[model samples]
Target chain A: MASNAGVAQSRALPGPVRFITSSIGAKVVMAVSGFVLVGFVLVHMIGNLQIFLGPEAINRYGNFLQGLGELLWVFRLGLLAALIAHVASAARLVILNQSARPINYSHNDYVQVKFAARTMPISGIVVLAFIIFHLAHFTGGKVQPELFHFQDELGQHDIYAMVTLGFQNWFISGFYIVANALLALHLSHGVSSMFQTLGVTAPAWRPLTHALGPVIGTIIFIGNVGIPLACSLGLVAIPAGAM
Target chain B: MHLTLHVWRQKSANDKGRLVQYEVDNISSDMSFLEMLDVFNESLIAKGEEPVAFDHDCREGICGACSLVINGIPHGPDEGTTVCQLHMRRFKDGDTIYIEPWRAKAFPVIRDLIVDRTAFDRIQQAGGFITINTGGAPDANALPIAKTEADLAMDAAACIGCGACVAACPNASAMLFVGAKVSQFLHLPQGHPERARRVKAMVEQMDAEGFGNCTNHYECMAACPKEIDVRVIAELNLEFMKAKISGRE
Candidate 1:
């Protein structure tokens, strides 16, 4: 133990990777990747909200995105990388945390710790499964190909009709509601903790930053769940012949 | 008042430990928790049994020597108070109390209700102090510091190096302790010269000690005997990022 005394610890690796494997450095990675994913969720929610306007509005929005060609793939690939990094970092931290306490306490108690904070890993896993299922159901056109075929007289894909039709099924609508709710629950803790990890935690900024997660999470939940709820309730009628 | 105690009894560092229950009667409410333990141990000594062993010093709470997870909460029920300061009145007349040692990979149990905390010392040695010496005590107002910054530094300085934060944290993270030590220096010019190198070395040593990472649960702040704010951890994070980004060793 005395062999390394008075010497600065040797760091073999040079760039960001060296630090990222450290305790706090991994948290920074989680925060940065979380930022990317949260932004994507917000924009995705807002974009999908266009469905409330009409089929033309949302269908045109889809056409515009599909029209991006290679650029869209760039965005998709970038987002996928962020997802992979976020999950990998979270898994690493989870294992480290579990091993930190090899012995169990006879009695466990919590003071001022939030429920959302405690369930982060479970909520994260559920949300990840929802994302994969969502992508397969929507983008890959694999879940329900019949609904995926909805199109307008312009012969372009009608995403509004496609989505509304997909949610018309009771089982699918229920799953969407449950998944979106857990996503909000996940965000309610993730958003606030993200700021702390990024070091945006000045005391003066506590009120605003602490509330950011639950507030933004609720808004996203309302926006996303409203679409599916409206579809199941027949509030958003199927476009004339597209369904 | 009579009390039932479930105390963890470990023979040595390698021995597996468990809660052994005992009953004590005629306890006074005015006795401090440690005093009550003293009474309990005396009874066991009279009965020719191995008495319980616990760590304590100064009994007034500043030393950070006493550690006990009383009824699952570190340092007992009182907020911003250490175990030595916990009085018997806090519990009911016939309450059952569970006492355990600080449980963490970095803090191995040395005996019953006592764990080795030299990992903290090693982290401190890694770089928890100012290397520069001012030669002697300086005159008041020699180097004026802003009131707010001074208060903030003192707030971080109030940490007594208690392991309650780690004991209370679900992850057993030592972020609050390290943050307090690092942050006390961060707000002053005395800490400026070696700031980058200090945070890096201390954090590296902390990780090497196998302490867990902070997840901002704020459990440490609640369990802290000093009630050290969680913002120091944010400051530590910021400083660490700066050091790494600036290519400091």
Candidate 2:
């Protein structure tokens, strides 16, 4: 063995390479970006709560955002960049993973909820679609006339009125509720996994991590869903000429 | 405690296998998991039925010969313990245990729960060994190594080639096993000479072996009887990239 080691050592030559090196760098990138995204979600949840302040208060908040103009464009660009990085890293990780073993599970002995864990990619894609549609309607200014009543207020589109009008439709509101529920499930796994990827959570802390995922996810779910549910119930009034 | 095992039974690689359940009552919980299986095998022999076949040699959990996905988890539910070392006490009495071989295209079922892990052997053969001739060598301590490096190398060397990591991974990726093997040698002064060549050859061998790429699910680490850290995989990746760029500098 010693002699073999020596001979092997005497002739060092280079080998083939791949784009992403495996030194936890990819996982680290995914985890760090995931963390930033999580923070954005929290901030978004807080900002969305302005809906409860009545149309005038909420519209003022929307106008305040629009007033930023170029600053708002920069912020949007930054968010877009972060989203691209997060997605690219995730895809890279998955691809690298796929290259290792393509065929799996000749015979699956019933592991509980096996399909759910296995369908993470499918769930993620659906959630991605939901995000796109939501942003298109709310931020992209592509709200369907039937879905919302876009109104001019203080030289800007009244986003608060649009949100209220949008939620007034049973179809739109129902879609948001369903999408939020899916988001909750996605976050349930994603949150706990982020900690594991970062190597922060210990085994003892796993139970807490598992429990915390659902709790935080449920809050986000309720916060997002609470809006449309309130509007549908007439607790928030629709603007007179809107919709 | 007594146990009823529904183990897969097959005469040969081409034979169709099915779950053949057997009851072994009043078994001692202190008996190792393999010992329990042995008791059942002995009973089958007396009944003129073929004994349940599984792979195992060293009951000490180091040989990596024992590769069974017990229940849902690989190597039973216990963490960081091989099937041979696992005791019957881990299961409750009257429990209907499901025993299956490592299910992967690369690892063909040789007989019952015994898979022909020659694929792993082939992957190892592709680049596992250093091409050094047997001869006289300098003193053992001629090349000094940091204690930390030695310790880490030892950790990587702990892999027994059991293929449990492959079985547990969702994608059936053998990155952990390949990574462990690569890291074990790369960390030492003896391996530095052929570091780049080793990575290139081993990686090619790994791809050629029909193993899947790692998806970062970390199930391999959890199922690993040796608890070999997934971080070693990262080290392997780094080494491979550096070798490709520097050309063995």
DockQ, model 1, C-alpha based: 0.60
- Residue-level lDDT of model 1, residues A39-65, one tens digit each, is 999999999999899888899999999
Pairs in clash, predicted candidate 1: none
TM-score of chain B of each: 0.98, 0.94
Off by over 4 Å in 2: A1-119, A139-143, A147-149, A184-243, B25-30, B129-136, B139-142, B193-197, B200-204, B237-249
By TM-score, the best candidate is 1
What TM-scores do the predictions have? 0.97, 0.72
lDDT of 1 by residue, B176-231 (tens): 99999999999998899899999998888888787888888999999999999999
In model 2, the Cα lDDT at residue B133 comes to 77
lDDT of 2 by residue, A111-223 (tens): 22334345556666777788898888887757565444466555556666677767878998888888887777767767765665554423467678657667877888989
